[model samples]
Target: MFKSRKNGVNRFAAATATHRQRIQVEHNSVLDSEYPFRLNFYNKPPAMDITIEEFELFALDRLQVLKVVEMAKIRNRSDEDYKKDIQHALDTYLPMKS
Candidate 1:
């Protein structure tokens, strides 16, 4: 067991912080290997395969997010509320980590 300081923090935890960060960077690299970039301006087709159900679900979710933005614009919402609504729609429908 690692010796703990008065604050109950372990020295080993601090010592391994860099190791954890390195592991996280490697994990992110692996995850991004699938479709790293947000856009494909060159018209490149996606290489990954998805089930039919997954494809439909993704399509519907994207449509919902677009509709939310459309409705927000039609309603002429305030700037703050507009951003909040858009964020809510994206988080609820088509969330992707940056």
Candidate 2:
């Protein structure tokens, strides 16, 4: 059986409790009782933007390359060879936009 030590101090538990209280206060402040729309930090952005479809495509390309890198690592490849393979994958999947 695990028992809490009287002499030992739990700093993590105290910090977690403080964080949870702060999050609750922030969530309560943002809650909109009347309107469906709630204003938050994400609403504001620069004029330059990419559409969701394009973003998804970019994410998919990166994910594919990551899978390859992970597989290379799993195979116990050398660090230099892993780096080269990762760089090659990135170059092939994510070409510079011109």
Candidate 3:
């Protein structure tokens, strides 16, 4: 697989096909509309059935986004630049759906 580069920085990595079987597993999940979004304070444990691979990806994305913010802070980037960097990270790693 070819990696995407920007400013001579390697941005993309090859992904192993490990999630296919996990995602195809039969599982019953509860989709409570009470928590349609993740930004709110949690009232209880979330009710969802996600594969291990998906969970791992979610965690990694969260860490990546946080890393971008922390790095921007350490670099003392301007507010607009910081926001842009965060937005780019979010858009690339996690997309919001309505």
Candidate 4:
């Protein structure tokens, strides 16, 4: 409950100034081993510039791909069949290569 001389500010709060200071950080400084999904941590969402339409498309595409994988598993397909089915779904929805 200490007081400042000049403006009568809380001296106790000033004494704990370091605790109130925001931490200076560089992006991606945290180690991957310490944080799985380093880019997608709960505190840090990915920075993306996309239209709402594009975002919905990406979300729907991922859902479709996941659904395919789940269906293949429920069918109890052979390992090769499962792999091929998932691969085909990924190719259609989340294509990485031409």
Quote the positional error of residue 78 for candidate 1 in Å. 1.0
Please report how far candidate 2 places residue 16 from its true position, in Å.
Answer: 10
What TM-score against the true fold does each predicted structure earn?
A: 0.50, 0.50, 0.51, 0.52
Report the Cα lDDT for candidate 3: 0.78
Error (Å) of candidate 1 at residue 30 is: 25
Could you give candidate 2's per-residue lDDT for residues 1-98 as a string of tens digits? 99979879688987887788433435553354443256645544456889999999999999989898999999998989999988889888987756
- Model 1 C-alpha lDDT per residue in residues 1-98, reported as the tens digit of each score: 98657887677988888577432334445335545664545445567989999999999999999999999999999999999999999999987977
**Model 3 lDDT tens row, 9-82:** 33343234433345453432433456555365776656788999999999999999999999999999999999
Global lDDT of each model?
0.82, 0.79, 0.78, 0.84
Deviation (Å) of 31 in candidate 1: 28
> In candidate 4, which residue ranges exceed 4 Å CA deviation?
1-48
Question: How much is the lDDT of residue 20 in candidate 1?
Answer: 73
> What stretches of model 2 exceed 4 Å from their correct place?
1-44, 96-98
If the candidates were sorted by their lDDT against the true structure, best first, what order would they fall in?
4, 1, 2, 3
- RMSD value for candidate 3: 17.5
Clashes (candidate 4) = 0
Q: Candidate 4, residues 1-98: lDDT per residue as tens digits?
A: 97548887787888898478687866665555445554644555446678999999999999999999999999999999999999999999999896
Candidate 4: residue 56 Cα off by (Å): 0.4
